[model samples]
Target: MQQADIHAAAQTLLSRRLNNRMTGPLKAECRPNSVSDGLAIQHRLLELMTQQGNPVGGWKCALPIAVDGLTDVPVVAPIFSDSIYTTSPCPIIADEGWCKIEPEIAFCFAQDLPHRPTPYTEQEIVAALSGAHLALEFILSRYLQPDSVSFIEHLADCLFNQGLFIGPEISLEQAFQASTIELTLTTASTPEVQHFAGKHPCAEPLLPLFWLVNFLRQQGIDIKAGQQVITSSYAGVIEIAPGDYFTLSYEDLGEISLAFTQD
Candidate 1:
């Protein structure tokens, strides 16, 4: 796609976000037709957001998937500074009276990893982390029918990331060793508890960080200090209602007690 088209698409998406609204696919002339186009739109979207004073605070990514002789590189999106919360009840824009969230672990960076030609080793990557935390990734898509849209379109819209709730701290070692977590969810609305044998989609949570740092480096981007990076979710999306208090227990690592309120 042309640069003008990319900027136009990003502006369209940003307007929807600023207005707290959703729309169908972009206009044909500016729609993303490839991964590169989607990434260009994302880059422009970040620039537009920063211009509006919402700087990038962190990032969210997943492992890469291959299909039809093409690799859909690990999807990535910036987590705006204004959207990250440390306390609850975290206000959210619920869809159809329901709030959606994903349980994941986040690692905060202690130092900057500047762009370089040399690939960063796993040891180097682990050494840079300051701490780990149990986190909930809030979801609210900018598209009307998210499933009906193409992957590129979703990628351009930051993968439905509305915000992030950074919960209590956990041991970095424990988080790294947590290949499987016995998760339990209790809510005020129901007496029954929801149990899930949560498994990291990539087996190791830090693996995606390793891939992400190198990927960004190759793209001439730096991993700045104080930025948190969340890998794959332990459990898929879970829906809860507003005015409901919920507690999520992640095995023995830690638990997060929070309540959801209407945005």
Candidate 2:
């Protein structure tokens, strides 16, 4: 895609986010047809958001998934600073009267890992972390019919991320050991508590961070100090009504509680 096309696509996405609205896929002239094109649009979107005062605070990433004969590259999206909440009663723009959330572990960096030719080892990546935290990723797709769009289109929109809620910190050892957590979810609006043997898609949360650091460096982007990285969800996505207080407990690790109010 040309720079103009990239800007156009990014502008459309930024507009939807600012206006708290959703639309169909981008127009043909500005649509991304490849991973590179999608990433270009994503980069442009981040620039636009930063220009509007919502700078990139962190990122969300997952290991690649293979299906049939094709394998996907790892997925990534920027998490804006303005969207990360450190307190409860988190405000959100609900989709149709409901909100979607994902439970995950977040790793915060203590130092900058600037772009380099050499790959960052797992130990080096871990050494740069300040600590781990329990987090909830708020989801809100810009596309009205998300399923109708291509993977590239979804990628360009930061993989449906709307915001993030950072909760309590946990030990690095505890975070590493949390591959398979027995999850229990309780909500104030419902009597029944939901339980699941939550499993991380990549088995370990740090796997994606290791990949993310290396991937961004290759793109001439640095993993700056204080930025948090949230790996793939452990218990998948859960839908809850607005105003419902919910608590997610990860067996032996930690728990986070919050309520989503309509923005």
Q: Model 2: clashing residue pairs?
A: none
Let me know the TM-score candidate 2 reaches against the reference structure. 0.96
lDDT of 2 by residue, 1-263 (tens): 88999999999999998998898889999998878898999999999998998898999999765522436854999999999999988899887668888888899999999999999898998899999898889988889888888877888999989999999999989898789989899999989999988999988778889999999998888998989899999888888888999888988777888887889
Query: lDDT of all the models against the reference?
Result: 0.89, 0.89
> Least accurate stretch of 10 residues (summed lDDT) in model 2?
65-74
Collision pairs in model 1: none
After aligning candidate 1 to the native by TM-score, how far in Å is the CA of 112 from where it should be?
0.7
**lDDT by residue for model 1 (38-97), tens:** 888998999999999998888999877763355865578889989999988778998766
Tell me each candidate's RMSD, in Å, in order.
Answer: 1.3, 1.4
